[model samples]
Target: MGTWEAVRRGRLLIALLVAAAAIPPASSAAATTLPKKAKASSPPELLSELPVHAGRLVPSSVVFPIYGDVYPHGLYYVVMNIGDPSKPYFLDVDTGSDLTWLQCDAPCVSCSKGPHPWYRPKKSKLVPSGDPLCAALHSGIAQGENSGQCDYEIQYEDRGSSLGVLLYDAFSLRLTNSTRASPILAVGCGYDQQSAVQDASAPTDGVLGLGTGKVSVLSQLSNQGVTKNVVGHCLSGKGGGYLFFGDDLVPSSRMTWAPMSRIGFRNYYSPGPAKLYWGTQSLGAKQIEVVLDTGSTFTYFESHPYQAFLSAVKSDLSKTPLIEEFDDSALPVCWKGQKPFKSVSDVKKYFKTLALDFVKGKRALLELSPENYLIITKHGNACLGILNGSEAGLRNLNVIGDISLQDHMVVYDNEKQHIGWVRAACNRLPNADDHGLEDGDLSQYASMGVLK
Candidate 1:
């Protein structure tokens, strides 16, 4: 996803502002600096475990505040515009981020490049900084000047890129039940991030925060005297989910529930509420705490548990090809036959001659585009599959991200204490292991708030 700005419009606005003497002082004016704190970056380890319980839906509707938007990729997104409640502009939406910011022009050292639209008040009535409406709009970002320059910037851990200007606008959102709520949205003026290699259709724009608080969009609505929790259901089929801002749309009694865990508000990257279980066992005593992040497309296990899983599943994995690598930049690996065997040849040439089984029964010829190589941790061999089914199973780890949850519909039902999943995309047919939805173990979802 990408946000674009018109350079000509920016120049014209600058010229008009200069002539009118409306531009703020270039110097002397203080720039807004948000609070800063550093967290330990060491790989997260097991912490004290809490009991694993599911949530139950209470009677009546509960309304919560929400900022309507979409994340097509790690890039472009869309936010409801407040001034023009009917329109949503594509902006960069980040989760490992707290300060929900947009591109704003402020003559800062770090500004977005290229041309795009700038937010000018002369043409719109969207609330400005310090205004009662703007102040009350659930902005967690550090107080900063929204200089009309329409430029902005926000960075991530992987050094994933997002730099642009801020464009003040209005946004409109509706709950699953059609309850309406609109807030002023900050659309990014421009963007600078690499495109995804897999699904190139992702749009990048404003971030939709999943933070917890009476001040977050969800909390604001909940506190605003509504009758629902933010009920989120990611619809993979349509490529987006329905976010109910202020209504209890979930069937709590029929659904499973889990207890909520308090996470650091500033550590936006933490998965926050989910628990990791040992192959469907009791929590805490035999489980681990984990963050379920969609941004990270791969599953990374802690060294200890990871090795244990490999030891247990090694026999199953061994039956497949023992490929030393999977270079996505060049040729991708594709295995054939019931049992895939490791091939020793030019990766590019071999990949073209084969097809990888992404899921059971599903096979696609590998292509060379965006580069990514799958490698073995020890011998540093380029391994084909990354199913690190550790000894801990599902009970000992901290997370089960997209890599592990593929072909499943993850339903975030805060109303009922647990999360839910519905197997949508299934890979069936003959395989060394049945990685299909109907096939494979259903034990993973047996304990959670899973629904038929």
Candidate 2:
């Protein structure tokens, strides 16, 4: 996962939460568990039942309204309901991470003041240390020390860390078909949190991990047959947007897809090697691998590409009326016009579009307009949103963050092993009526009240 970068000061906070371990309960219609390896005759089957409200059938898709922005907030978040008697917690939406967690009230040793009160877990909710999920979290390490309860610790790149235990709790979700379902999921009940930031009030309660991993919430949902192993988000430049899980919300056509790269880290969504271009001219930078990470606030490039891009932009601006704003500390690079710029729209005309042409797909090109790479600071100057990854300890890694993803519908199709994107008006949710189920699609879900 990419580190969370503070847009104001460019500080990085990388995340790595450890702990582990799900099966849906039988009492709830929405709950169903994957068969244990010892009990199953073949591969675990899909849920034999889906919850139905009254007599009407519902879709498997789950949607959440996204809040916050790229500037002051430096991240986007969503409110989620958890536990038996559901309570809401504000979670930062992160596609780069896999383990979803919440700050716990288990006699917190070191914790930040989050938006909500700490989560109080019942004894029954604790995941047993012997569980397979718990073993997965303790992978690559010895685990017998925590014999009774599953213990976990996540350390970030910025030296921040979270210590906690694993627990199974109900995730209250309202499907796109306008019906509610509560699926049991594994979550980290963090009791200790050490952050690099000194701010007392935490920006979010915790992170909602949407990465492609077995322990991810998406995989848990897929295991229970609540939804397909797919997720998509639309972050509007204006402020708020929406996120959805399942293929039901995916468009039938018109979106461009690039095959997912397995070159580097298996957890991230990488689209293989891409050549950088300033308009139609090549920047002479080598083809670099890029990862689409929502956890990062700004786009990042290798040192060579960063320097090349910086020089090109500066040389282009020399011919224009825009002058370098050396005093502005909002970003590494800033440009001031004759008058203060209120938004990207006010100064975008002065800048050229950037493009990334991927080598793996059929002319797969990600176009970054001036709006996609420029931010209007509080001082009313346009600042560059692209940063140097090498300085941030990213080394050769290139990342596409929130600034470059604004107003685009980016989909992580884990089931198909591909990533797709298309320009969109992200301020509102897609019409539910446009995504009706196809033939035989209804059979994938079991009848109400039936269980495997």
Candidate 3:
């Protein structure tokens, strides 16, 4: 799928998780997996404390993979590595995404499987586990000695990935303070293979999903403290942001509140880049505590008010020669001069225009001229369905995936209560950074909202 199309179709199209290597209990929903509760309080004392995380943090920058683009233009930088911490790896500390991976050693056939871009170990300074410097990492998050190489395969809600061996690397995690510091245990590794159409690429190592589960890097960091919990407030826009690994990072103020529902780890994760919902009407009838996920590209909700949403905007479309769903995209163009020729790209544009009304005053309808918004599937053909999650049977639960979180600053405070969001206007630069994208793919377009 094209980049914007992926965004519009469902920002939550890709996600992965490494479970207990065992089947979840039968009670867990087929799509969701709640996390197992660990020690509620932080550790009593730092287990093998590393002074590197202490002292003055440094400025660090990590790359975010711009889905569907093929050049560096699609990639943007997030200040993640705080100073010169002992371990550093580029990570999109996202609740929307699941797997925590990094770029690793290349030259393996297993790494070339997917169409999306994969990380290349060759460009990174962090060596694979086989190297002597990375022995400690293997003992921690990289656990395993049989093979000193980093290897992992994670399956997200929508996508599955195979990552190469883990390598101890440096990553930047930015703080709202305009300061950067590298995490002490940053690891680097990339997906070995990706599906061709997925638009995967090797941006900067991999993503770090900070969901409410044991597998999260935040949870892993908890191995260091007691009484203090990990807290992260990822600001939505360009003023930049900070992610707190421990309690010391939290601010002193009255915080918004929401009772957290500890559910299955994978089942409850939401998609991100963060979408804010204001007003009581936007909150809907459900008072569910949710996580914002970046791994997914689309939104998922229980039949919520989808029908109401569609009913409100269905009349805005015009009839065209496009066909919505076709097992084969190569269709016979019977109408040679039809004004609205149906195509996949047209379908994507249609969804993009439709999503504007869902958010509060947030209009992503960029240069979508009349000609630019094409049609797919005939006006009444049932084959071309607008929403994709319904077909995949992901509608049972409430999830605000990528599509819904667009253009807003989301604050996911697991330490506190409730997920908070605020309106943000970002300048969508044309030079979309595509650092991690695959070759010859113009479908991906990464936009770093230069917060206005």
Candidate 4:
């Protein structure tokens, strides 16, 4: 599906902070005296893999931290360095969308107050035409309105678009051993933008597409022989998570693999008959077209099945001592006032964990903890992060957004067409395969501690 049809509308809140934990500053001597040519000309290095399994060779790697916000449940972003004398940029990471691009200095009437100044291609010092990886990129690029410079255009679902050009620059990846390296590739630089593309609140520097399309950044790298076409991410409920490129499996995490059916129309992955589970009870539905999307902030199910699920939840909540009601207009399924919660943490006390059961030899995944589905609002109310999704024109389809997929390592393997997951604490550098969890026995995985 195109980004316009795939993504939900709304601007992610402008993130002003950086996510990397301990990046050593490039020496001032190198920053000042080093020729821009040397910095731009150095052969990009493939990243070293974080060893997890027995003797699995990982040649190239790229690691970036994704950050999330609490209130509006904004989208996640990662820090990527580009250009000569490399400057860091915060890009919203998405697996559903196509084409990776950044806001640049072509010409602008209005633009979001980005985390950093726009990337100037003139000073970037890399020729886009000569890069072997950019050969395909040069074709799609069109000229700007008045300026004849090479330009690219991206249109989104919510009437958003970013216009720019293909620029060749060094894409820096921080290695696991505390060293930095870069791989020169074709990266987009947007000069003009409109609507959600330039959201001031979540003024993202750009977007990094991890999509399965040929035009995507991951596809470009794979074609250039830099890395494999595999992606894994573990978005935490609180915000941020672990993300890695290639099959750099960590020892602490265990994953269950399900083959992705190429028979589907969309470019994304999904499991067949993905039924919803409340503890041991299976709340079956017609069909759950699960789009493992990181673009949206909340989980969305179609109305027919979603409404039934909501009723079951309300009936379950009725068993608890009813709380005094207040204005609870912020969310689709919400409860407010002092009736149930002393704070947001008390939500898990009443709610049961939900599992997604996929058909196959694969396991039923328990990805959504209470904190992942229950969002705390500014009005001291607990709002459900799950929505009807009618506005997005999703009619019998369910979107497995970032919220519901939190604290679980989701691997999208294009080579094997395998989609897998395992429950994880996420913040730690865990390398465990699906070691502890039982895929065959449903009764084995009881819900963990309450949200409180």
Best by TM-score: 2
Candidate 3 lDDT tens digits, 1-452: 22332222323424444422222222332112111211111112222222234652222222222222111111222323321332333444456543456433344444422223334442233333333223332223443333323344555444445444334333333322223333334343543445323554433335666665444555444432221234443332222233334433233433332334444544243322212222112324443333445444334434444444343334323354333333423121112223444443433433333221222213411121221112233432222222334544554444544334444434445555444444333222111233222321222212111111
What number of clashing residue pairs does each candidate have, in the order they appear?
Answer: 82, 3, 112, 20
Predicted structure with the largest lDDT when compared to the true one: 2
| lDDT (0 to 1) per candidate | 0.30, 0.73, 0.35, 0.57
Those runs of model 3 whose alpha carbons end farther than 4 Å from true positions after fitting are: 1-16, 19-93, 112-151, 165-167, 172-180, 186-188, 196-205, 219-257, 267-291, 303-305, 315-388, 393-395, 425-452
Q: What lDDT score goes with residue 196 in model 4?
A: 48
**Candidate 2, clashing residue pairs?**
16-154, 17-154, 48-446
- Once model 4 is optimally superposed onto the true structure by TM-score, how far is the C-alpha of residue 156 displaced, in angstroms? 3.0
Number of the candidate with higher TM-score, 2 or 4? 2
The TM-score values for the models, in the order shown, are 0.48, 0.85, 0.50, 0.73
State, as a TM-score between 0 and 1, how close model 1 is to the true structure.
0.48
**Candidate 1 residue-wise lDDT, 177-230, digit = tens:** 323444333343322333222223333233444344222344433433333444
Rank candidates, TM-score, best first: 2, 4, 3, 1
**What is the lDDT, from 0 to 100, of the residue 23 in candidate 4?**
16
